[model samples]
Target chain A: MSVSALSRPSFSRRALLILLSVLLIALVVGMEQLAPLFRALFPDQDPAMYERESFLNLTLAHLALVLVSSLISVSVGVAAGLFVTRPAGREFEPLVSTLAAIGQTFPPAAVLAIVVPVAGFGFIPTLVALVLYGLLPVVQNTVAGLGTVPSQTLEAARGNGMSAWQILWRIELPLAMRVIIAGVRVSVIINIGTATIGSTVGAKTLGTPIIAGLVGNNLPYVIQGAILVGLLAIVTDLAFERLERRFSFGESGAMA
Target chain B: MSASHNPTRDTASARLVANRVLVTLLCAGLLAAWLLPFATMSPNRLASGQTVGLSEALSAWQAIALLALSAVLAVAALRRPLPRELAHGVVLLASLGLLLITLYSLGDYAQRTLVEKSPSARVSQGSAFWVMAFCCALAAIDAFQRASSGWLLRLGYMLIAGGSVAMLFASGHFDDLSIMREYANIRDNFSDQFITHLVLVGSALGPALLIGVPLGLLAHRHVRLQGTLFSVLNFFQTIPSIALFALLVAPLSALGNAFPLLGEWGIKGIGAAPAIIALVMYALLPVVRNTYAGLKGVPPATVEAARGMGMTARQVLWRVEIPLALPVMLSGLRIVTVQAIGLTVVAALIGAGGLGAFIFQGLGQYAIDLVLLGAIPTIVLAVIADFTLQMLVVLSKPAGTRR
Candidate 1:
């Protein structure tokens, strides 16, 4: 309980960033070196397919989808979580929980099929499904986080004459921020992984090359898709580690 | 007056009555709405534009009977503190009933000659049916556990309620199985491929449990290693499965190619083994994180007492720490497995034989039916795995879990 790491120098964060950037650089270098070999091997396939086309488009699309949907999902999930968790709105809690749980329990690919006719294929539907599938962790975490917020802190907020809204925005959210962040981190990571499936349905993302390569049995193309994805995931994860540190309490330092 | 503490007997009674009524109404409303498409006087004739034929009526009746049986089981759940064996029996019967209903419903839907015109009987065999049934089962389980009577009996009530919904659909499908010759999915000779899917899933669990459990245990014991272990594993998990599948291809293939002997035994570096290895990597974070968190969560005094009694470090961990951490580790395993099953689709890219092949196969061929054949089984396996793990988690909980 006494493990306050706040007094630590900020330089460690710079160190972390450098460490992560170097990792990224290394991957890029590796890819650059392999480019010639890959081209030599796949003269028949489009040369730029590995370079400017699949890898970059996939990573960007993945980042964009995850970034937008995570923001929307977390905002809505946290808000709904706050609303439904109140004593007066308690009964709705079960319904929300059920919906959230079910949303995740079903396969997103199957869900994509169901959503396709309704939402159409490609970006929006896949994005929407990702948002829905990603909603549970943040919302559940919010509910549980707020639930576990110290009673004394809540009482202090009330004693200070903060309105319910203020208490939530100021006292509760901040205290629960770490937990909520943990939830968001989980959602973000899962979304990164799940985003690959978007290609199977033709979103023009990185998964397309992977899926296409799989079907065609092209090893270099497959490696091109996979390496980029794995690299992006690692990079994005490192970014989150930094973000979590800046906003969260003392535990952020411990988190990485 | 503090409302939670307004302990007057009359107040408790009134509250109980109100709750019971609400539960009943909500349960009925949801269940009925879910089944509404099935309950028509005339059956839906998707193929012929005809009303439900008489034969369809018979299946519908059986569905209704099955539903009633489920409801009756829920009612019986009102009976208190069910005997240990009886509780197990009810769970089994309800499960059996649900299975029977699905088999029957599948039969009816699959059978072109079955003369069933009602979509209700057939609908329960699909996605909506699964969703509705799962919801009902949850509600029943909640109500049963929370019932004013014994905990076991309350749980039984819930099981019965859920079981009935599942049965209605299952039996509805099963009875019509004989008629379903035309729409049969794949000539999936269940001998090898089925075993392959199971094996892939099973093997993924191998490295997962092996790597995850030790890391979990080690991270739990060593404070210094915790952050590094957690971050590394978390980073490992953050990589999307699709990417991981693709990423491992060349290196593994290169290794296999470099070493001639490795390539022959299905170890030619790139496909199945790499897929399994990557799947294991994907599954590791949850196990380790949960195990670490679970172990760290052990009461400080408990560990202190174990040490005071001159217990060796090994003794303390094996005897005290693990028993307590079992639930968390098991849950972690569950998450890993469900995740592995779903993510296994990525393996298809590498010729790691799996159901994903059909899904991707369908995608390429533009065959919707083939996609469903692959996707449906994966979903079912995920759900089934989730529930089985849930049962394990519930059963393994330390107190008030003997039921």
Candidate 2:
């Protein structure tokens, strides 16, 4: 009975996840077909649909930016976190942690604005901003995750004649993988939201329509953009939830 | 023992033991100051500027003096025989000096180069100047962190640094700088928008706490309601702020149309109404989650003891549970407050007037200083909010719980 109770909910959640993903793609691809509906909703506006860029193309570009930036952030942030935790690099730990904490307090919009002057407005500048802003969560989590590894476990690994590298790879990393992935999840989610604002600076993302609509005072375009972006965020968040659950399950199964 | 006997070897080893963080930051600052443009001179606000190198920005002797001071600080950081406190003191003072000298030189250069040439001519901080400033701030912060564990002392040091800069500004030393010029142009609007930003944040926070805390208490009491409550709040949180604000426009406008009285009260498609509503929605999750977690985190034994002492559930909750949960709940408030402050800047995009108006306007006009005028204060406000709330969280800890 207990097994069935758990399994049934898992099945439904997977179904919901797939359902949302399908709905998101359908909305992106067929946004114009729903033009009449939008026109009805927003009766007076001409060009009720956002058509300067294809929603499909915009979605892809948005995802690509988030992926590239999150990739760079995770790699650099995780490495920095690891470096500062090791014995050779321990003295720098406080500085790195303090930086991570303080960096998060700077608003993403401000960071993007500052980057424009130095890097100018475009994909590269937006990517730079997203990576820098997304970094704090990953670094903080990496440090926190690695710190959770028990001293006894490290001692045992050392007693077995394992090299520091071997222990880190074998014992420490696996133990910390769940937390690190949680960080990545947060970074990716934030990057998705932030990437929308990138459209303000000239990077083609879903926010393009919203900014354009706001400027033009067209409600339909704003709605179209907002709906698609909202869908994407919800879909991504649900996917991460599944991923986190899988990792935790695997961790427990390994112990068993 | 043998190394101590050999003074030369001891000194060599001492040289190897450098304060890596300070040395690295100082060296980077030096290289950036030497290589990057120290300032820019623009003919007008709209036009891009000509880059001026450090030597051109300052007199020969002044440039050398600044470099000499930085080099001395780096050497002081490297020598192990120097006392740690002394090294930190030297680093703090020298970095502060570098910061002051850099700013003074920019103003001096601007006065000499632009004041007579064109009244509208602007002097902006160049890449090198920004990099140098950033490096100095970080190095000074590191020194402060190392020099004192006490918050009061660290705050005192910060005040000394910040006060000096404020004094310099007050003295009109930076009058020729572009950002200051922008401030002069929009002085009235800047203050008005600044107040609006604070008002927006406060309005949203007030409603969020009122709704969220009770919901949190309900969730804590009822095991079954917790999941649904959190999921709903989390769903709201997952939407991007821009998207959330935009999404509210249609429905809100419809409401305003359906009820003209609501429209009269400023409940419209785009403005503070939707902006505050969306902010409150975004804020609810943190407050609710934190409050629930705080309440649930109270020790079962303590709750039992309270009951055993003939205390009613209400008394136990009010007197014991609330006090114990205060710190964690305040931490949640900290996150909510800071997040709201940042989000308020984005609200300006929707016509919810705030510092973001300057930011967006600057972005529109390609005026970097105008952007700075907006972005800098938003960051400062967020940082100040974060620091103050962190102190609150620390202070709220019950006597035995203080760290």
Error of 1 at B183 (Å): 7.1
Model 1: TM-score, first chain: 0.81
* Candidate 2 segments exceeding 4 Å error: A1-11, A249-256, B1-15, B60-65, B400-403
Q: Could you give candidate 1's per-residue lDDT for residues B84-129 as a string of tens digits?
A: 3455355445534544453444444445443544433232233334
Candidate 1 ranges with C-alpha deviation above 4 Å? A1-14, A18-34, A40-56, A98-110, A113-120, A250-255, B1-187, B299-304, B307-311, B394-403
* Fnat per candidate: 0.54, 0.55
Clashing residue pairs for model 2: none
lDDT of 2 at A20: 87
